[model samples]
Structures are given as structure tokens and as C-alpha cells.
Target: MEKKRTISVSVVNEHGVLSRISGLFAGRGYNIESLTVAPIPESDLSRVTIVTDGDAKVFEQIIKQLHKLIPVLNVVENDDFLEKEMALVKIPIEEDIASIEVLCRAYNGNVANANEKYIIVTVTDKPYRISSFLKAIKKFNPKEMIRSGTVALERY
Candidate 1:
């Protein structure tokens, strides 16, 4: 059955690495649902987190192809990792700030900023929790919102 699969790849910090990796998936007709890439702290490496949908066979093929890439160092699947995503939501300040704060608190978030026009609330958590928090706060009508793609690390 097709389902969401999260993969984290460690690769050398080199130009065009992302393009080559992404191109592999594109060339194979796979669609990436979410992708996050950032330099590794104090190291000459980067981490790429990709969320995609496929069955067992297709997912295995992706991992095999990923291993063939010269720059890739390691590949990890979701079950062996911890993941999180962040979202910043700007809601109308005219709406109840107190209630909003409470909701944010429940989701490990807080009012990052408050101005005359809007309140910027930030939440960092599992992707599903972030999605739920956003849905619950829609009554305030988010004026602006941004969500980061999945970032992950090995469970060890």
C-alpha cells in the first residue's frame, strides 16, 4: 500500500548535491511531498529530509538509487528516526489573544510576537501536531502562515 515515508540522507557539502538527489526522484517519476536540507553543525556535511509516498517496492528502489549517488553518505527511514516541523502562524490580533495563547501552549508553542494588526504564534512539534494546531486555530483566520518541511535525526 502507498503511504507516507520519511527519509533522511547525509551527504557531502557540495554544490549540485541537492539537484542531483532530487533529480533522481524526478527522473524516476516519484513525487516528493516535503523536503528539508541544511548544513550539519560543525561538519562538512548536510542533511536532507524527504517525505514521499510509495509502496514497499518503490521505497526500496528509492533507497537503492540514493545509495548509488556519489555524495550521499547515509540514508535513514522514518522508523529509525525522530522528526519535527515548525510553523509560524500570524493570526488577527483582534481575535482573542488569551485563548490563542492557551492553544499554542498545548502544542508547545507561544506567541512569538504581537503587534497592532496580528499575533505571530510559533509551534514546533511532530508534523501531525502542527497540522492539528493550525486546523484548531483557523477560526482566527490566519493572515499569514509558513511551515517548514520535515527535519529529522536518527533515533540513536
Candidate 2:
């Protein structure tokens, strides 16, 4: 069966590291659903968080291959990971601003920017909650929407 998975890889912070890691997935014909990469503070390592949906057996092989990569320092499977996603939606200024702010607050979000033409609302929450927020905000008729896909950290 196919299941969504998140893998966090601690890798050497070097040029082309991202491409090599991504190439590993492409070479295997696996698709990455979302990917986030950032340097680990005060270190020569970066954390790459990848979200993919695929067969368990094939996913395991990918993890094994990740472990074998020379620049890979560590591989963390999705177990006990706290995942969050951020979504930004632009709504027409004609919409009720107060109502939009109230709705955003309910989803742990707030009005991030506003101008003569539109309001940009930002939300950060669990992926599922972000999805709910997007669905709920549809009534406001968003002009543009973009999501910063899943960023995860392991929880002890």
C-alpha cells in the first residue's frame, strides 16, 4: 500500500548536495511531494525534509540508499515528527477584513499584509489544519495562494 512519508536527512552543507539527493529520488522514479532544506544552525550540516507518497518497501530502499550517500550524515524516518506547513492567501480588499482576520486567528494565522487592492493572510499549522484553513478561506475568494510545504522536526 502507498502511504505518505517524511524523511529528514542531515547532510553536509555543500554545493550540489541538494541536487544529488533529489537525483537519487528521480533515478528511482519516486516523486517528492514536498521538500524543505535549511542549514542547521552553527554547523556544517543542513537538514533536508522530504515528503513523498509511495510503497513502503520501495520507500525503505530509498532510505537505505540515503544512508549510503557519502555526504549524508543521518537519516530520520517520520516517526514522532512534528510537521507544520505555512500557507499564504491573497484575498481581494473588498472582502470583509475583520471576518478574514477572525477566521485566520482561529487557524493560528493572522493578516500578514494589506494594501489598497488585497490582503495577504498567513497561517502556520499542522498540514491537515492548513488544508482546513485553505478550504475554509475559499469562501473569501482568494486571488492567489502559496504553501510552504511540510517542515518537520523529530519529537522525543
- The lDDT leader among the candidates is 2
Q: What lDDT does candidate 1 reach at residue 46?
A: 96
lDDT of 2 by residue, 26-80 (tens): 9999999999999999999999999998888989999998998989999999669
Each candidate: how many clashes? 0, 0
Q: What is candidate 1's lDDT per residue for 28-91, written digit by digit as tens?
A: 9998989999999999999999999999999999999999999999998858768899999999
Inter-residue clash pairs, candidate 2: none
As a TM-score, model 2 comes out at: 0.96
Off by over 4 Å in 1: none
Off by over 4 Å in 2: none
